[model samples]
Target: MALLWSRISSILPPNEEQFPLQFSDKVESSVVEMLKRSRRQLYCDTTSTSRMLNAQIVVDISWERLNTGTWRDVDKEWRRVYAYGCLFKVAALCRENPSEDEVLQAVRTCDMGLLMGAAIMDNILQVLVRILQSELRKTAKDEDESEHVEIKRAKIVSPHVPSIKEDLAIPRMKCPSLESFNTNHLIPLKPVILEGIVDHWPALNKHPWSIDYLRSVAGCRTVPVEVGSRYTDVDWSQTLLTVNQFIDRYILNKDQTSQDGGKPLGYLAQHQLFDQVPELKEDIRIPDYCCLCEGDEDDITVNAWFGPAGTVSPLHQDPQQNFLAQVVGSKYIRLYSPEDTDKLYPHQSQLLHNTSQVEVENPDVERFPEFAKAPYLECVLQPGDVLFIPVKHWHYVRSLEVSFSVSFWWS
Candidate 1:
């Protein structure tokens, strides 16, 4: 396909204005025939052939192909490419679930983001989303009572408030050894910044983990990205996009506004991204500090945090001790001792009990007056800094720039 596209590009007019409309009718017809053959070969059940024949098409795109076209034209082609990318991803998903029934089931649960992102066609995207949603609803109605109970639990919500002072700061240290770290901080449940701990990590080098490098290697891997003011916000939601799309829309084009007028923060938070893309794991190292554990190496949970500046993690506590290794950009981290539990009011909602209700940056002090007195230790973690956060220590984190951090959690 690359070779064919290259040949086509060479014959095309160099001036963008003279180039033809982007729609390739031949390619579209060929794609349809391919889908038909795939359905026939995979599901030989004659009774279901008609439904497969009429399967709803999610992508039918037309736009200007040349660079001289308006921004709208460029955006149109972008969506077309994204839609094709998603179709390939859907095939991958189906391959993962080889059985015919399971493949169809997986497609029913696929979200709108996989079908389209920044596509400028919200009306069409809405129609596709509703189709999937309707299928999921029907599936739920057909499920047993146990499944219904589980679904209901996910919908339930309860609210609570937390308290934490905005002005306090967390403590910092420089490269404390394993022995000194355990004696001075770990055993005491103290939150301390350990600088120079990640200086040797490959991610700190100039080339491999750069934006261009990451896009080249892991670009096609689709991962869930958070889009919102913060995870705790009522409007928060998750969307799927390729790493290349993420870098293009959120990282490279940081200043441009989305269809929604607001500049929503895009966060790839707390995902075991290294597990999903092992190549990325090569860029990071498991700090020796995690070796303090008596169990096997698997006891440690490694999560990647990548996002643009302005992404916020509401005050929350984790179950295991954490070493948050900063690789790129900076983050403002604020920590409160576990002893201030009552002062730092936790949410009453079961799902968010570990999360605080207070927005640390701009607290509603009048409503949660005790928040004004709750002491918090704060620090801006720079590249190569690893912040040790003891279990159950209330911490509020916000990205100070386009940032990427690897967090190691162990019992």
Candidate 2:
């Protein structure tokens, strides 16, 4: 069996000596084993035996041979290669449970970005999906006992009227600390980003059968491009996961808790959710694949992920630092300096200090009149862009399209 380098040759640059895969960089043990074998047994010569399926084709891809130092640039080149070979399109790939040959296949196809990000995506997806399945099973049994119980629907918080910015004053305080935000341990504020962050697990790449399974089984669909035209100019629907599947499969289960049925926010840095997911754990794996790396990760209750068309998180400050990353789509964010919290609105009720929940699109000037004077710091984060939101900085997040993201907060 000889190497099937012809098909992938176009994708690999001629210089392959600069980017040898490091053990830490490799996604799976099997792929690494095969690559190691190729060099030792056949002088890095790939063969048909290396092919995982009836596709007895192999190719030598020496990442080391490439002269480029910047992977970002290298990725741009590889993207063109995939496009030329008709292997280009946006699709999900799992990083865990990949077969030996399948792992090899990914090594053949993936460049730096996909290879790295896919691993994280695969692990997160398994946990999230598994949790959803568990929730569904619990709900199904609950339905059997009482067939007429209403299945709670996720709240559509941004459909009718645009929330108005409230007239709450930003507290005039020091640069900032948790003390300013939390009073008697009652969290005054929490930050959340609604974005789909999928990891590239081995199962997704090796098992060619997973595409339809993930798309259909998960009831995944391309997100809507427009909700009501309150977002960016790009088509964002294609990036979001079909969350309805999680509802049908997991929220309906009998073993699930009622609280679990509601919208979930943030990531859990645990792998007890799935046997396979645990095998693929990596260092610094963010729960939801989007953990806020700032200090004090635990004890911060980030309870919501709002992603409706025309949905806008009102200008408010949070107690903890925030890390917001866009996985599937994009979002437009605006922030005000802490000193100017007065220009934005601080809650008189204190219940709404951080999250005004006030309709920004439509405001009752008499009740929340101070909102009109706040200055805003705005930026839009495209896929993979991360925005760090400091505490007490009044900010608003709006979807430019059918957007998705994961946000983390720390006190």
Considering every candidate listed, which one attains the maximal TM-score? 1
lDDT of 1 by residue, 162-210 (tens): 2324455566778888899999998888888887877777788745355
Estimate candidate 1's alpha-carbon lDDT, on a 0 to 1 scale.
0.62
Top candidate on lDDT is: 1
lDDT, candidate 2, 162-224, per-residue tens: 333444322222222334334311243332222333233232233321112333232322111
Clashing pairs in 1: 162-345, 163-345, 169-377, 169-378, 170-377, 170-378
Q: Write down the TM-score for model 1.
A: 0.61
User: All predictions: root-mean-square deviation over Cα?
Assistant: 18.6, 18.5
- Assess the local accuracy of residue 39 in candidate 1 as a C-alpha lDDT between 0 and 100: 38
**Global CA lDDT computed for model 2:** 0.37
